[model samples]
Target: MRFCSRWVVRDQWHEVCLYEDYFLYRTRAADSTAPPEEHRVENGDIADIGVDREGPLWGITLTVTSGESRTVPCPATIAAPLLLRWHDRD
Candidate 1:
């Protein structure tokens, strides 16, 4: 499966993509030639999901089974659907 979406982190927008088994994300300035940062997580790797409020912007926190966590700012409109997709996997 493959999916891509833009997310905000530290007030900057980034492109986040999930292709096959990799969760790849990178800054817009990085461009296509730049090597993107990759994260490895299977369906069950995600252990928890939570909403984070930063003023008017909404974000999400993902806790992995290994106890590592990552936070990314996402619009409320996309949060539910995205989280639901992951939820359905487990």
Candidate 2:
């Protein structure tokens, strides 16, 4: 499955594309005059996942196999199905 949403990266909002195995993101505020900053993260290294709901926002925390973790926020409406996918995996 694939999903497109807004994600916070380096204190800025960017358009992110999430897939089952990885995610891709690009800064939305960059001007066309300059190349947009892009990044990707592979899910294979993710060892644990957690979810938190704060009003309408959903915070997803992913822990890497190496013990690093980061939380990213997205709307609950979009996160519900994604969380379900993770649940089904287990």
Top-lDDT structure, candidate number: 2
* Highest TM-score against the true fold, candidate: 2
What is candidate 1's lDDT per residue for 2-90, written digit by digit as tens? 46677655656566555555455455443345555555566456677677855656777767888988887777766666666555643
If scored against the real structure, what TM-score would every candidate get?
0.61, 0.62
- Model 1: lowest-lDDT 10 consecutive positions: 22-31
- Deviation (Å) of 85 in candidate 2: 2.2
Error of 1 at 16 (Å): 3.6
In model 1, how large is the Cα lDDT of residue 56? 54
- Model 2 gets an lDDT of 0.66
lDDT of 2 by residue, 1-90 (tens): 466766553455656566778756566442344555776678787676678988777777767788977776767776776666666653
Error of 1 at 18 (Å): 5.2
